[model samples]
Target: AMTVFAEKYGVKYLAAVKCLHKDADALLAFYDFPAEHREHLRTSNPVGSVFATLRHRTARTKGALSQKTARLMVFTLVQAASKTWRRLQGANQL
Candidate 1:
C-alpha cells in the first residue's frame, strides 16, 4: 500500500510520502490491538491531565523547585491521578 502511494503521489507530494513511509509503523500500530480497545487507546487523556498538573505546578514554582523536587512532584502527581483514571476497555485481551 505504501509503495503504491509513494509511486502515485510521491512526485506531487514528495514530503508527505516520505513522512508516511518513515512513520507508517507508528501510524498503523493501533490496528494491531483488539478492535474493542482501539477507541480507548486513542482517546485516553490521562497523560494530558498529568502534564497539565505538572505544568501548573512548575509554572507556579518557576525556578524554586530543585530537580529532585520536580521529579518527585511529577511522580507523586501522576500516581495520585492514576487512582481516578478509568480502566481500559477490553482489558481481557491483554
Candidate 2:
C-alpha cells in the first residue's frame, strides 16, 4: 500500500524508508534533491515565492483541523496549492 502510494505520487520510496531509519543524507540522495531543498525541509519553508502562499495558507487555517488525519490532509492540499502558485508565478528557483 505504501509503495503504491509513493509510486503514484512520484515520490522516492527509498527516501521515505531511509527517513524511518534517520539516514538523512541517503534519503536526500535517493531523491536527487539538492542540499538546498534539505534546508527548505528543515525550515519548513518553501524555497521561493511558494513561501508566501504557504505562509498565508497556514495562517488562515491554523487551529481549524482538530484531528491529525485532517491536519495532514489539509497540509498536503496546501503544499500542492503552494507549488502550483509558485509555478504560475515562475518564481520557483529550485
Candidate 3:
C-alpha cells in the first residue's frame, strides 16, 4: 500500500515519508510514559480545550475582558478544575 502511495504521489511525497521514517523512534518517544498517561496524552487537546472554555466564558459576557482579569479568570478556572484531574499511573518515576 505504501509503495503504491509513493508511486502515485511522486518523489516529494516519498521523500517526506522517508524523512519521517528517520524520526520514527523520536516521534514515538512519548509512549515511554505509563499506559494510562499514554492514552490521555495521545487523545486529549488540553490547551485547545482550555482556550475553548475561556472563549465560551468570555463570549457570554458583554464586553472584552481586561488583560489582568482574563489572566486571573484562566488561573482561577484551572485551579478549580485541577481538583478533578487524574494523576498519572506512575508519575513519581518522572
Candidate 4:
C-alpha cells in the first residue's frame, strides 16, 4: 500500500511520503492489534486534542503560567478527558 502511494503520488508529496517511509513500522503497528480495536487505534487523536486544549487555555492566560501551574493544569485536564474516553472493544484478544 505504501509502495503504491509512493509510486503514484510521492513526487507531489515528498515530505509526507518520506515520513511515511521513515515511520512505516510505527504507523502500521496498529494492525498488530485485534480487528475490533483497530477503529479505536485509527481514531486515536486524544493527545492532539489535549495539546490543542492546553494551547487554547494557556493562550487565554497570555503566558502568565508558571511551569508548575501549567503541568498541573495539563494533568488535570487530561484526567478529566480520560473519564469520557471509550474502552477497548476487544480486550479479550489481548
Candidate 5:
C-alpha cells in the first residue's frame, strides 16, 4: 500500500519499507543505533523502534529543506535574465 502510494507520488519508499525488516543490522549501524543494544534490537519488534526512527528522521530532513529559498533564488535569476533580454532587445531596436 505504501509502495503504491509512493509510486503514484514519485516519492522514495525504500527507507520506510526497509525499516520494517526485523534484522536491519546494517541500517542500524549506519544510523548509529547504540552498539550495545544493536544486537538485541536486531530481533526486537521494530514497529515503534526503527520505523519510528526512520519516519522521524525523514520528516526532519524533508522539513529542513528550504523550498522558499529555492523559489526565491529561481525567481530572482529569471527576473534578472528577462530584464537583461529585454534590454538587449531594446538596444538592438535602436
Candidate 6:
C-alpha cells in the first residue's frame, strides 16, 4: 500500500517512513509507558510549547553569563509556564 502511494504521489513522505523504518524498534518501543502517560509521550509538543517561550528568552541571550543567572532564569520561566499548563486529561489516574 505504501509502495503504491509512493508511486502515485511524491516519494518524499514515503522516504521519511523508510527512514523511520530504520528505527522501527525505537519507534515502537513506547508500549511500556502507562496507558495514561502514553498520550503525553506521543508528542513533545506539550512541554515544547512551554519551551517555545523559553526559546525566545534564550535566543535573546548569547548564553547564560553565570550559572546562577541561568538557573534563576530557567526557574522563573518554568514557574510562569506552569501556571498556564493544562492538566493532562488522564493524569489523575496516575
Provide C-alpha RMSD values for all models, in order: 3.9, 14.8, 3.8, 4.4, 23.4, 4.7
Lowest lDDT sum, 10 consecutive residues, model 4, at: 85-94
lDDT tens digits, residue span 6-42, model 6: 5665455767667665766786789877777787777
Which regions in candidate 2 have their CA more than 4 angstroms from the true location?
1-46, 63-75, 82-94
Candidate 1 lDDT over residue span 25-80, tens digit each? 99999999899888887887777888998899889888598889988998999998
Poorest lDDT segment (10 consecutive residues) of candidate 1? 40-49
Q: In model 3, where do residues sit more than 4 Å from their true spots?
A: 1-13
Put down candidate 2 lDDT per residue, 1-94, tens digits, no spaces: 4446455654546667545457555644745755545554554444555556556666787947557855676677666866544222222654
Candidate closer to the true structure by lDDT (higher is better), 2 or 4 = 4
Instruction: Report the Cα lDDT for residue 65, model 2.
Output: 59
lDDT of 1: 0.89
Task: Show how many residue pairs clash in every candidate, following the order shown.
Answer: 0, 0, 0, 0, 0, 0
Q: Write the per-residue lDDT of candidate 3 for residues 1-94, one digit (tens) a residue.
A: 5446556775768786786667778877997777767877887777777777777888887547898998899898787766866666667655
Order by TM-score, highest first: 1, 4, 3, 6, 2, 5
Q: What is the lDDT of candidate 3?
A: 0.74
Global lDDT scores for all candidate models: 0.89, 0.56, 0.74, 0.88, 0.50, 0.74
Better of 3 and 6 by TM-score: 3
The candidate maximizing lDDT is 1
Error of 2 at 29 (Å): 28
lDDT tens digits, residue span 1-93, model 4 = 999999999999999999999999998898888789888778878889778878888999998988999899999988887888777887777
In model 4, which regions exceed 4 Å deviation? Answer: 1-32
